[model samples]
Structures are given as C-alpha cells and as structure tokens.
Target: MDYKYIEQLLERYWACETSLQEEQILRTFFQQQEVPEHLMAYKAIFDVQQEQAEATLGEEFDERILEMIEGDPVKAIPLRGGLRRRSFLRPLYQAAGLVALILTIGIAAQHSFDEEGQSQHTQFAQTDSLERPADEFVTVPETQEAAVTVEQDSINLTR
Candidate 1:
C-alpha cells in the first residue's frame, strides 16, 4: 500500500503543522495491527495518545485534590441578606456623619463671632462711659483753687 499521504502527514505533525483531523488519522492508522516497518517506530507514540484520550478520573477526583492541597475539606458558608443591606447603607451613614461634623464646625464659628462682637460692644460702652462728663465736680472754696480746677478741666476736655 502507498503510504505517501501518511508519510506527508507525519512530516507535518513533526513540524507542528498537522490539523486535528490529520492527527486523528495518524493515531487511527498507527492503531492498526500491521504497520509498515518504517512507521512502526512512531506507533508507540500514537498508542500513548489513544490511552490518554480514553483515560478519566474517578468521581472523588475534586474532593481528593482539594484535600491534598488544603489538608481538609472546606465547607461553603452561606452569606446573610444583612451584609447586602449594610453595604447599601454604608455611604448614607458616612454622609450623615460628615454633615453633622460640618454643622458642628459652623455652629462653633458662629458662636465665636457672636462672642467677639459682644466683647467689642462692651469695650465701646466702657470707653463711652469713661469719656462722658461726670454729674458732679468737687466744689472749691477759694477763687485761686477754683481757677486751677477750671484750667485742669479744660486740659482734660482737650485730651
């Protein structure tokens, strides 16, 4: 039999260029009992591929792999709806706290300004009382003393 096509496909497979169908053809051809002496050497390679294709893991494969890696079988914990509700309200709670902080600062600043204004008004009133003339002055019996007192009052008025 002419095996020129098989030889060509083997060349392509060695060069990593064979399509899936062509590779399957090679595997099937090698599976036959009587293979050409020249191609007999490659039959073992295709036989291994066939064996691997038919291989499967047992039903406990996943559990065994997990146990090997983690040393124990891990159970999945179900999450509560409360976690979702808390996540939804987290931003609202932060916003409320921020607003309260801003209001506190604003109130403190307003209170400080009001106190400063009141102090200024009190200082102005004290200065105004000091500048106002007294209701009574000391009466001098002597004319010379009265003249001295009048001159002193004139000097105080100028100040």
Candidate 2:
C-alpha cells in the first residue's frame, strides 16, 4: 500500500479532524516497526498513546488515598466549612427546650390549682345545702358587733 493515504491521515490527525476509526487506523499503521522515514514523527505520538492506554492508577493509589484520609480525618469531612458550624446554636436550642418544658410544667401546675379551686367551690356548694350556714365555711364577712365583741370583752375585763 502506498503510504500517501497514511500521510494524508496523519495531517488530518494533527489538525484534529480525524475520527476514531481514522485514529485507530493510524495506531495500527504506526505499530509496524517498518515505516517510511517521513512517518517517524507520528511513531512517538502513537507510541505514547499506546503506552498510556495500558497505564492505570493501581491499588497502591487506593492505599495512599486511604492512608491520607486516615492520617487526617478532619479533611475527610467534606464541605464542612460551608455547613452550619455553630456550636452555640446547640446550647441555644437546649435552653429554649428547657424554657418550653418549664413553661409546660408551670401551666400544668396552674391548671391543677384551678381544678383544685373549682372542686373546693363545688364542695362548698354541696356543704352549703346542709344545716350549717355557708358563713361557717370562713368565707363570710364578720358583723361589726361580732367583731367588736372580743374587743369590748377585753376592755371590760381590763377595767
């Protein structure tokens, strides 16, 4: 085969106009040790690509990356700098929850006191229907004469 077509393809390859099939043809053409003296420049390009095609970052690379992560666990926390890094908010939330808990307990205690007061009022109403006057329950106002009776008796005894 005349290498004129191969030379044309090489020009196309350098110009980046060659398709994958054309590139593959070039690789096969360069794989032959016997090439015309003019095509020697292309051998290095194809040979480098062939060598790199077999190249790989092996398990040693994986081990190195693992070692790097284990050596500094702080760097492993991805994008932590952009996250909400405020420790203050944790304490603030705890304080707010504590305040809410205390308010709930206080409101419950207040409700209990109200219930006790209502029960006492109802008991007073039931007891009020008995022979004893509701005044005996100690909620009534004292008469002026009854109030002064003790004072007058004390004065009379003193006199």
Q: Which candidate leads the pack in lDDT?
A: 1
Clashing pairs for model 1 are none
**Residue-level lDDT tens digits of model 2 in 1-159:** 698899899889989999999999999999989888877877988889999999888999999888878866656645454243443245554444444334333433443455554333333332332222222322222222222333343344346
Each candidate's TM vs. the true structure? Answer: 0.40, 0.48
Task: Assess each prediction's global lDDT (C-alpha) against the native.
Answer: 0.58, 0.57
Would you give me the overall lDDT of model 1? Answer: 0.58
Clashing pairs in model 2? Answer: none
RMSD of each: 25.3, 19.6
Q: Compare the candidates by TM-score and give the number of the best one.
A: 2
lDDT tens readout by residue for model 1, 26-106: 988999989999998899888888889888988799887776666632234333766656656666555544443343334
